[model samples]
Target: MSEQRTHSPQEPQRRPRITHNRKKTRRSKAAAALLYVLFVVGLSAVLATVGWIWANDLLALNKDYTSVIVKVENDESFGEVVNDLKKNGLIEYKFLFHLYGWFSNADDKIAPGTYELNTDMDYRALVTNMSASSSTRQTIDITIPEGYTIDQTFALLEEQGVTTVEKLQDMSANWNYKFTWLKDLPLGDYHRLEGYLFPDTYTFYLGEDAKYVINKMLVNFESKMGDYMDQFTEESQYSLHDIITIASLIEKETDGEDYGTIASVIYNRLENTGAETQGYLQIDATLVYLNGGKVPTEEDKAIDSPYNTYLYKGLPAGPISNPGMKAITAALKPENTNYYYYVLNPETNKHEFTRTYAQHQALVEKYGTANEEG
Candidate 1:
């Protein structure tokens, strides 16, 4: 048995041969890896194609169309907006547009308005232009001139159909605004907001309440008066109301360049301690206001009105007109002078200032008329 085993071993030990199943298993693994790589590449290409189409749709997809007005209702939904764009031919891809809106968080931010849209607008432009609050409402441009009285301003607004006269009068009388300067104002007629409405150009929208416009003017007055607010402390001789009243007088009395000098004359007349000229402002403009814009006669000057400076000493009951910034500034910072009288020189359209009554009489004789008195 040993000799036979040795003879077989000499035939040698044949190594283990590779089976067909094993070779097939290795080839299968390589093929599976290659197929997986090919599948991944194909999926990536498909995704890239879809991304490019979506981006193109969001950008300049509709660049050659005419503009169209599209109205979005107040409680409209994003889906409804997308449908509206599709219906108006403003957008082509509804799904992609909605997706873009969702991604940009613009779906919830779209304002309800009548939007001016065009097929030439991209998704971004359409979203931006349609989101404005003003686009939904109608607006009017109103220009209120300087030195216009409240009555005058009301007339102008009524003429433009901005509001009714009754509404404006009602608001003016009873608004009870909380301005600090309006706190201690002397009780007067419904024109309590006389000088408080700062005169300037304004833009008012249609359908706005009367109080809205009034508050807008008051806010503008407060903003413009910010520069002079610090000067109106308790130590100052005049309140803000007093300064505005004086400024209104100065505005009606003289031109731009002579505001400071006219303010000085007003201050001199008020601050004078002399027995002859003490506490008498003698402003003819106040008499004009009392006479309802008419030239005041001697009888009109003697009328019993607090606004009559010829009768009542010191400033008038309130402002005579809404003065502009130039007059307001001059009233805040008056020229330091002893001049107490001024008369308009017809030859030069300027005021002639004088210190004493005698010098004032000289200017009156030189420049005054029977109807015009300083």
Candidate 2:
């Protein structure tokens, strides 16, 4: 009864004091978890930054290395190209390129075209260039002569310090290149370097292989011919190889643009009355070709070879030389005029066109004699 009479209000008890050791432990655990998360995040960031730099720092420092990328448009695979790049010293990191391509989902979508890539290209620019549909490759201004034979072309290459004739011959021997027009050739041998070595100012590089040169010439030939091959075959009742054969004849006839009328004259001769077994194309150039590209003397005409037009009566065995687009076009559309004989004015290196054989004979007399004594 006495205790109940006091009836004092109860006070809330204070929480128990936290131990110093416990506080330390809790802080240490939280700090360790935060540190682990930070370490993981840092590791992830570092992995993301892989392939951000090229090993060749000087290369990266010198050029913009952006926008321009060598895009390979062939059916070649990425791994093959990567290996090529490594060999070419164009790529410093193979795995990184693969990673970049995979991350960008462009691994299988690489476009088939040659592209020029500048150095210092980032991951984005790399993929962009590789994914483009087409790209222009670096080119060298290679000039093939009007009547340059395959061997002559190789010789020119050797002279330019590009490659040797032996290497080219080895490549040709190693692989047989058969074209559509090859089957139409007499001996099934039209494709080698017969009509495709287009005479033009092409662009090439220092490390360009023979295949690259051949492809460029082929592309140029295709561009020039277009639909003319089929049309010429239909109109002249000759095969595409035949058209090129005539074009090659025209190329050997003259060095430059003057061959247009000469090309027409050849057709005219074929259609004329003095035709000798498919019109004995008594081309002096053929004799010159047969005489190891030397000016043939009267005695050399007796030599027998399929390439000698003076002896054999039809197109030569193969293209005597690489002809330019002008020569090709002239072959496609020969002139309507009919002038059988032509003599190059020695002073001008141009031919005087004459329709009648008497006029030709008179000019020959005026020039000197029938043998071209010069």
Candidate 3:
């Protein structure tokens, strides 16, 4: 009765139903947008990952390795070679390497031999190197001992089938190397390069040119002298040739441990102001050099050759042999001492130093003759 104006049953709340439907539609739209955003981000991440993988596979990224030798047999296929490269850590992606080889037509062009390849090379360089005709050469291991003269070095090379003595002599005489140290060298026989060729183990290609082999030794000598070059030029009164000549004598005179003291003795003999031992480097090694590796007799010491240090004053004509770095360093920096004479003790294979001739004679009597055989 109070609501007498109620009429039928209202209109069933049309406004509320319309507002509810609008809210439901809004929620559905928001969920669809969120899902779209998530799909787009996922797709971008996948694309970035794929791009990085492709770039790394094709390009030589982060490749750091030394030289490696890979042997390819005559019967091996391109795929087999690639597999070997992959196994040797020369390459990263085998599939891409194979594809590159096929595309470049390098698969069939590869030579069958040992290839000296490095890891720093990219796929293109690696393939090209393998395909080249001069990809391989047989190498020989040659060891050049210290204190060997040029003649001895030539003999060793001839023994190893590296080159003939005549070829080496000719190369040494005529080849004009660009080393600054070689510019002022005395004009003479092949022995002019006597002490310059560094003594070390070397790998030379079989049947290599004589010039190439000799240059390798020279380059090594230059490299070994690295920082010492400036020091030698600045600190020493003697020229490089003179120092090398003295070093050769030191190398032949004693074992390595006494180089500095022996160098001092040589310097003392050459520079002594005393009337008795002044300017006479009475080294036995020079006599032996003059005598051609024979034991020096009393008559040999009296010979008038420029190399006879007993007869002539100052350094010899040139170096007697190739001395190693230890002897060279000693010649450059001799110990400061007043002692002028050293007699080799046969029992100890060491020398006894003396400042006076009387002391030297006593030591000679006590230690036996300096020429006693070791």
Candidate 4:
């Protein structure tokens, strides 16, 4: 028998190298470290997201609006102009707008003008609109003189690019303009806005409709005359028709308030000539209204309407001009005077008042024929 080594029972059996299990423990430790690192990175990312939200909410932009007029040049670069706006404090955040335009390829289509800008404008839209020759909105100022008839008022508007004079003339006969009071009244030729329209300085936007202008004038009339409608309460004498008729004469006579008294003198003659001879209270103003002629002939006197002082023995049919407050006040409260006839001093625009026809005729002959005044 071969010699067999017999170990003592106290000694243990040794295992192979592959079964040691040390390497396995090391691999597991490495995997756990990697997982821990990944979890830390995810937590950091979540925290950063929360902080960004809070910062954005706290830092909103606030800017005041101002109106400024700018003239754009032909061939000017839009980018250069946007840079100018940022530099001038006219716009906020110039970069985002410029980038948006560059990305969208809309850099060349901006409009330039006096702009009313506020914080309401977005970065991209502000740049897009501010960069050319177009406007978001347009504004204009209109001035209507104190004594303009509707036709004359239209001419003023036409001269200022508001509308054509023909449009106003056409509307006088249009169905819409046929007022409730004058709807059935003929329009061959008539006062467009007599008691209905008012006179005052006003402001308006560009491209306003003709009807809007008419409405504005009417609104003014309502405001000023709302309380004074009953100014002529003694129904037997002072009527609305008479007040407007006298007011129109006052408007034509002079712009001076003092002339209100003189205007009253002429009205008295038209209403109460003191005799029953049926004499005509001839005035050149009606002829001017009818034919735009400076003077009236015997035929103009035969216009044959209630408006004709020559045909009738009283005041004319209606007002000839849009009167101001002074004229209206004078019409309501005429000064007590015995004068009946008057004539205008062409150079002074002042009238000469007299009580008798002979006195008035002498004044007329002297002023009407004497060297035509200096």
Mind giving the per-residue lDDT tens digits that candidate 4 earns over 1-374? Answer: 99999977886767667754888988899999998988888878887875554333222234455545433433347777667666655555566556656876656555433344444455555554454333553456666766666667777777775545665455544525533334434665535456456777666433445556566766677678777864545554767666777777667665374655656665666567553323455565665667664566667867767766656766677777777777888877778886766666767766667777677678778888531110
Model 3 residue 97 distance off true place after TM-score fit, in angstroms: 34
Worst 10 residues of 4 by lDDT: 54-63
- Each model's C-alpha lDDT? 0.80, 0.65, 0.79, 0.61
| Structural similarity to truth (TM-score) of each candidate | 0.63, 0.58, 0.62, 0.56
Query: Would you list the clashing residue pairs of candidate 1?
Result: none
Count the clashes in each prediction.
0, 18, 0, 7
Q: Distance (Å) between predicted and true CA of 304, model 1?
A: 0.5
- Candidate 1 lDDT by residue in tens digits, 1-374: 55553443457679888798899999999999999999999999989988777666678562566777676654578899899988987777898887888889978667665566777778887788667454534456888876778888888887875665667778788777778877765343559999988988887654446777788999999999887787778887788889899999999888558989999988888887573567788888888887778877889879998998888888898899999999998998899998887777788877788788788788787776642444
Identify the runs in model 4 with alpha carbons over 4 angstroms from their true place.
Answer: 1-135, 169-190, 232-236, 255-257, 276-279, 297-299, 302-306, 346-349, 369-374
Off by over 4 Å in 2: 1-140, 173-179, 183-191, 232-236, 255-257, 273-278, 370-374
Model 2, position 123, has a per-residue lDDT of 47
Cα lDDT of model 3 by residue, 1-374, tens digit: 57565566656655445878889999999999999999999889888887677566566666677688876654578889989989888877788787788788877677655578887777877776675345454468998988998889998997886667887888888888889989887545787899998899998755556788899999999998888777556466887888889999888886658889889988887777563687888788788888888878889978989998878888888888899989988988899987788777777777778888888888878876744321
Question: Model 4 reaches what TM-score against the true structure?
Answer: 0.56
